[model samples]
Target chain A: MENKLKRKMLWLDAWDIEEQEAWFSHMSLQGWKLIGISKWMAEFEKCEPQKVNYRCDVFKLNDKSENNRIEFYKQSGWEHIATRGFIQVFRDMKGDNSLEIHTDPIEQAATLSILKQDITKRGILTLLLSVITLMLIVGAHQIDPVGNYLNDKFIETIVLIIAYMSISITMVNGMIHMSKLMKRLKSGSLLEHEKSYHRKIKRNKVVGITVIFILSLWVLTVFLNLMNSLQEDRFPAIPKTELPIVQMADFIDDFTYIDEEGLSYFKENSSFLVPRQYQLEQMVEVPGETWEDNSDIYSPSISSFGYEVRSEWLAKKFVQDLKEKHTYYAENYVKVPESKFDELWLSQGNFNAAFIARKHNKVYRVLYYGKGSIDEIIERALAKAER
Target chain B: MANDQRAPMTEAMYYVLLALYNPLHGYAVMDEVKKVSNGRIIMGPGTLYGILKRMQQENFIVLDELDGRRKIYHITENGREALKHEHQRLTCMVDDGKPLLGNGDSNGK
Candidate 1:
């Protein structure tokens, strides 16, 4: 085993078979014999700097036949150095002119097509899937912005989409190069010209590292934000009742009036994961506010839940859930789809009336029990959210 | 021409089969080709192995022997037939050019 070892980062496209072989040959002349290749990294065993011919081939094969291929190449004075995926790299100390596996340009092109074929087939499928996933995320944001905001899986989904797109672009780029090389071969271009990947390899390494750095920073920022939010009450208070989502309350036809004590206002701004949420729950002290309130008086109060959503998708989702859970049918439950806001008028249900509206980024979800129509109580709350 | 199905053979294929007629390993074939062509044609290991593998699979060549890491290959009857047909094609072109160029031309002036 050679004690001295070195590694190099490279981005070898499928058509780069010629370049990889040339680079390997050049490396051997500097006493570094390639020992292994894994994705972007190439490992070499250092030795006495000597002129040696090296070649890399790309082909699909099963393990059993691969053994035979390796054995055959070995028998031909070629030492198998490293294999990464479809690439097989070999080195030989034989005369520089005595190392080509395929002398015929036509044959060379045919063999190189193996990689092109694989990428063409699989790249299209992968590209299609990635595109579809991206479209789904866009649609999700449009359908319900609020739920999508609270969706903790957004970061992972975006990362996966980006990665898939990168892989897809690489595959497409490889295929394009393959076609160009094949065309040049068909039109009589020397194989030696495209054999030096020095500059390209350096550029690829920089790009690869830059992309990895950016992705790492993206994930790290989210993780750090989550950690910070978990450690401390991050967001500032929702500001003194400078404006409340719930202003006043009243009953419907029975003329149920407000308790005049002013609604009890409770404000909370909290965060879980990386997202922050502001919740404002105001209890309208009606004739029978709660089971205890009902025992004390006929004040049938409605507990309203409102949120200052961070995004449009989250706001949309909040409105959607409110409509699904609270809206009922028949005379007791009248659906008002044409209302200025998303409204449902009710006279006898658990929620006498439910009004869901979104102004800018803020969301208002009012479930009214004792109300003489949603306007009597929530008009001021709506005004506040609108403001 | 004999098979009618095999595409026109390339110079590399021709020399490879020609070199294998005497049973040679991949490196030897490369050297043999350069030697025969007077250093005009040089075959690399990648092209050498590719031709050998394809020829063997197509029955134009066969594994003659395996000595350690050197696998010696010999041209098969199919390889010989293919080479013979290529020879005929080249011969016709040479013969047809004989009258036009004047064999040993400078003397004709």
Candidate 2:
């Protein structure tokens, strides 16, 4: 068989497709006769460096010395590197094959290390970008009014809930899948073996974006609806026309408003009056009797009218009073009986105005009326003097 | 079975060397191994490339660069020596077992 000049082939760990092709061309240029090429599996199978059969293609070139061939493989960038498996050499036996030579393949334990080097930078960036996208979605939820809408309404709530679940799943799954891909890179597993994983990433992106967009839209819709509801309930627009609005709890007597414009004007004016009467009224209802007995003046006009009062102006006044010795309407002083002030503030719009008398000292006070009987107002005024 | 267990040559190494003993390229060698092993040992393409590189380094084989895609290889003198040693070791053990069995001829009647 040696004298017959049969095809000779070598298998090596670093022999990728392109290198092998280039090597083949180089040998052809050197006047080696081309023969039928076959794969080199038998030799690798016996070596079994990775506890599995090693398979490699063997290109048979005739009229080439074995020494020159090995040199060719090395010089052509097909040099043996440490690998998990082995490489083998073979000859075309034709009819009767003989075992001519064999050697253990190089221990390519470092291929995994090289492969990881190739992918680490890109892999980390991809993971980082994914995390940023997740953070943006979470940040969006915090800033927009969508969360409240999702909680309150039906369609939007359901959609947001589903979106939340989907996004969370996609984010978690994508990270897990990506981590697995990184592990494979570290392990020196072939890229071809991991090709099917790309589709999973794509699917996750699609699902995640869909979920985020839907949730964002749901949140936006809910915010708009809330604004509309508030506008409708609080200060709805009315055309100029004659309409009767009877006096309710806020008026001293049953007064009729014939003009819609006038009613709107009155309600707008009501906002202004709400603060004036209620501000000093709360100070009189101080929780402790000691402070009440010590003070001379008190007022509870806001509570008598039965209006739901808010004390934004009053709170501002207090702040201003703290800074300045006196505000525009009243002098600043640290009123005792803080708990009484809280109760009076909470129920100011419903308490009888006659009962509220501003007490400045132990024996001094000023009486005021807010939709109360004249007799009650006179009695409260006289009682203040007696105190 | 005990002797099999003591085998120095692994199945992958044995089969890969066997596959390359024929005139073949990377894919062709893989197919040959699969066929011979009845698909029990299917060599992936990447694995095949890795093995080809390692074998070429140890002087066990030499690459034939005449073909572009299929880089062929052949066994070397040193490779042959190792293969022969393995073969002789198995052969001697088989020969030693002959004494225990009646292998005179004619089906040992």
Candidate 3:
């Protein structure tokens, strides 16, 4: 038996945590009996030379009693030992930590190759992120493919909730880890002359990340509010009549005719046509003078009143357009024959569409129709369609 | 460099500090400390690593990571000064305590 005083434990500093664990596991795999870890410096310091007990903060490995033991300190040219036996294999499997900047050409070349490989991997990840960002930006216009309804809104809300929760969890976890690392790096209470440089670095990184997150949140809120307000403001007031000189040629090309029933059904089923208020114009084109009272027809005085009685006219025109146009939303309009049109218009008191209704003592009926920014959507959709 | 009051510290800490005082690697320092102490008060690999790490945080040591697993270390001027003080204090303590304990000295005073 070897003298008890002659045996020693080997201590290792692996390249990184994985290499360290691998080495420990490998030793155990080779039929070495596992020993318990030494939690503190004191336990390790109390180690008796050539003792069977081997200890470390991580896993502890002990060779079989018959195998010769070498004290880590007693071993000659340990750098060579570490570089040769288990350590060499460990470094090969992981990475070499022994290569200095002033290393010989061969080692330096190998290090450069590893660095190049890492850079390539990073480049690929960056490219993937950029492509994902670009796709989101380009696809922002139609972010909602499903019909717009309370359900779609509910789903969107859920998605936002999930995204927010994930981000919060990740940020909190990261912050906790960072704080722990900082604590480990800092020594005891600071002294007057002691500059805790690492603490300062940690604090700066945390503050910077937090500030960026806050700023992004603020910016996103403001941008969404602005878009919402713009949408609200752009829609014209309802019950107006001037028939805003829309080119008949453009309307004919852009729209197909639909029956009133079909229009109402489409509007009811479509998520997009939420019950929104609107402005309208009804043109009163009189047939060539069998009108006995022709003066009111051309009067500049009644121009502002065109919006007053527009609902009845709007209802009439809305139904007429359904018959004449294949547009989807129809329930927004209700048809009234020329007989009840005047009464319907005159009965409503002084509202924009109602005001115009009082003056029309018309002999013939008019049409009611749906309103939209179809012209605007037409321009955008046409470009995409072309592309 | 020789006259700093914070110099002349405990032999063990001083030698430990000095071994790492150069750009010597960590394991190399462990072996050297073993030789310097003649295997008495032998520095364990783990203890040396711990001290080296602690000293780094204290700004007394810096990792010379020009190599990977080898992790060479060097002492800062502050470390040198601290080691000197520790050496002085520990030596004084040992000298003062020996006679008092009636172990190694003739004069109890």
Query: In candidate 3, which residue ranges exceed 4 Å CA deviation?
Result: A1-154, A178-387, B1-15, B20-27, B37-81, B92-109
**Candidate 2: global Cα-lDDT?**
0.39
Candidate 2 C-alpha lDDT tens digits along A1-387:
132233543332122322333333333344442243445311111111111111222332342322334333333223322122222222222212121112112222233333334334445565566567656655654454322222232354357457545645544543444445445544654323112323443564576567778777877876876786677534333324421221122223232323333122222212322322111111122122222345533222221212212344443333332223222224223333442222111111222322222212111122233334534333433343334
Find the candidate with the highest lDDT and give its number.
Answer: 1
If both were scored by TM-score, which would come out higher, candidate 1 or candidate 3?
1
lDDT of each: 0.64, 0.39, 0.36
Candidate 2 lDDT at B86 equals 65
All candidates' TM-scores?
A: 0.70, 0.30, 0.31
- lDDT-best of 1 and 3: 1
DockQ per candidate, 2 decimals: 0.43, 0.03, 0.05
How well is each residue in A1-387 modelled by candidate 1, as lDDT tens digits? 548888887666545777888787788788887888877789888887787777776665465424456655665677778776777777774555454555567777777777778777877887888788888877765554434345444565566566666777777877787788788767766467236687777776776676687689768967886896788643233344454456332232232334344444344543323144434433333343344334454344555555666566656666565455444323233455654444433334544666666665566666665424566665655566666
What are the runs in model 2 whose C-alpha is more than 4 Å off?
A1-165, A168-387, B1-10, B21-23, B34-69, B73-109
DockQ of 2: 0.03
| Model 1 TM-score relative to the real fold | 0.70
Give the candidate number with the greatest DockQ: 1
lDDT digits (tens) for residues B46-67 of candidate 3: 3454455446777887766674
Candidate 1 Cα deviation (angstroms), residue A116: 2.1
